[model samples]
Target: MRVASLMNVLGRGWLLAERALQVFHSTARETRALKFNYPKGTFEAWAYMTCMETVSAILSQVSQVTFEDMTSSLLLIRASLWEYGLKKLYKLGEICQLVPTSNAPDENQINRITSGITQQSAGGDSEDQGRLLVATLMSKQQFTSKYLELGEMVIGAFKHAGRKRTACSVGLDMAKFHVELGQIEEAERLLSDMCSLYSPENWTIFSANTISLLAE
Candidate 1:
């Protein structure tokens, strides 16, 4: 359940979702009370279902969807960014957030995994469900802007459990996340302060040059 792998599944899931969208033409496809195995569903299952739901609900009445005839739906974009649920989907986000940064996959890896999917896409305005995938990849704190609060919680949890090593790894992940978003100074500060905490197995995979350049 690493972030990267989950995101890749989401990216692929969105591509598969396009097939479902082709079912309706010019009219919205309404799904009422679609009973899913809630909370019991695996992450992959939930992710795909969510992707399908969000896309269908957000852009309905497409006027047409001709998968065979790309020209048929001139207004339709093959790939797009969907901002579904806004900040409302917290439970799902929290479940994902608790996964340790050490185990979670970062966004860059997700991009690499989806590169082939992008190359094969049938030309759309943007990739479908891009933001949704990214949001899922976000740390719970980062996703919800509860960083300071989450930081304290994490520190307290790890310290109470006598897991100083685990604390360092989470801190490193926070630094790396900032780096991914181009927040170099913040990342560097975190890394430097927690330098002694880094073990051979836990430093971020991002290049030293990239880290150094950005930290400056």
Candidate 2:
């Protein structure tokens, strides 16, 4: 059936994004171990660049999805870019170009996703897919004043939808935006709130390992 096929495609996209995340985390750990002694050598630069390219490739693959479909592939790409220290704003511009401006995925679609998933809890996987889409968009948009306006709309919808995890992620995205704009104090406050939402054990360990790069 068409429904089953669509699910399969979305499932594969999620798997690919997850695999890419693992690769990024492993490379980052190796890079960190060599950080202090890493000479400004061509080989070191090449290695770093190669890792970035891998991340970019995976992101591009996720971007191929239609806006109406699962958004998790896109979110994974954004998170991976963030993890790899890619310039979020620049990437946002690239993604905006990929989707037709008039047809770009919007908060309404996001709301549908939130409502569908949170109501059933059986929709957790689908919720993850939707969050990935929002994360991808946020990564591209950064936390500019315009994005902040959009965030307000998104947060409002999340509150109404009752998806606590997605709401927390939207908050985290806002915090990341503040961090990008050099509002370290505000960003830290947002991050503190985010940390309070989940068990410390469930936080992505790979993210903690790459904190230095992400901070940069």
Candidate 3:
């Protein structure tokens, strides 16, 4: 899949490249969920993240990017980060003797630990995963700045391309992430920017949920 994605990317087949990445990500998920025939941890979670990052790097090579492209890329990267952090936390638990070592770690235990990490971020949804991932990184209190820098770089790219709605959406997610880390002020600042991007006609359930989170 890696080679396929790279070949497609070189051929300027962006959609095909993304499809390969999706297949790789799905395989990784199935492996983690014990549905795949591969051994547990056969597919490292960071591999998907790295692939997404690589695609993001070459996005500039495309002369034009549509809304769908930007949104899809955003979702792909978000999932990558979530899986990256989730697997990292589980491995860390094993190393620290906080979790039992087994071929397949308990999913419920992972969920419980994730819940305990951040109250407002509890759930299995992508947004929840994103916030949980950020919270986990922040709780470690290491390389927080680097993560933030990468996030801002992505967000800035969207904004620079005049994809305000997409940029605001990602920024809102990033804010919720900060909220999980108890960075209320920074979260509010980002949330404020989100509000301006929404109108009554264009407001969506996601937008409403973000606002509700801010209200809380």
Model 1: runs farther than 4 Å from truth? 1-36, 39-142, 198-216
Overall lDDT per candidate, in order of appearance: 0.41, 0.45, 0.52
Model 3, total clashes: 0
Tens-digit per-residue lDDT, 1-216, candidate 2: 133224335644344445555664676587778775532222222222333444344444547675335354454444443433333322343334322232343454434433433443323333443344335444224324435554544554443444446656676767666765668887676556555544443656533533433365
TM-score of each: 0.29, 0.29, 0.48
Ranking by TM-score: 3, 1, 2
For 100-173, candidate 1 gives per-residue lDDT tens digits of: 33445344544442343344333221345434444444554454354333444454345444455555555665
- Candidate 1 vs. truth: CA RMSD? 18.8
Best by lDDT: 3
Query: lDDT: which is higher, 2 or 3?
Result: 3
Q: Which window of 10 residues has the lowest lDDT sum in candidate 1?
A: 79-88
Residue 178 deviation, candidate 1, in Å? 1.6
In the predicted model 2, the residue pairs found to clash are: 71-133, 72-129, 75-132, 92-140
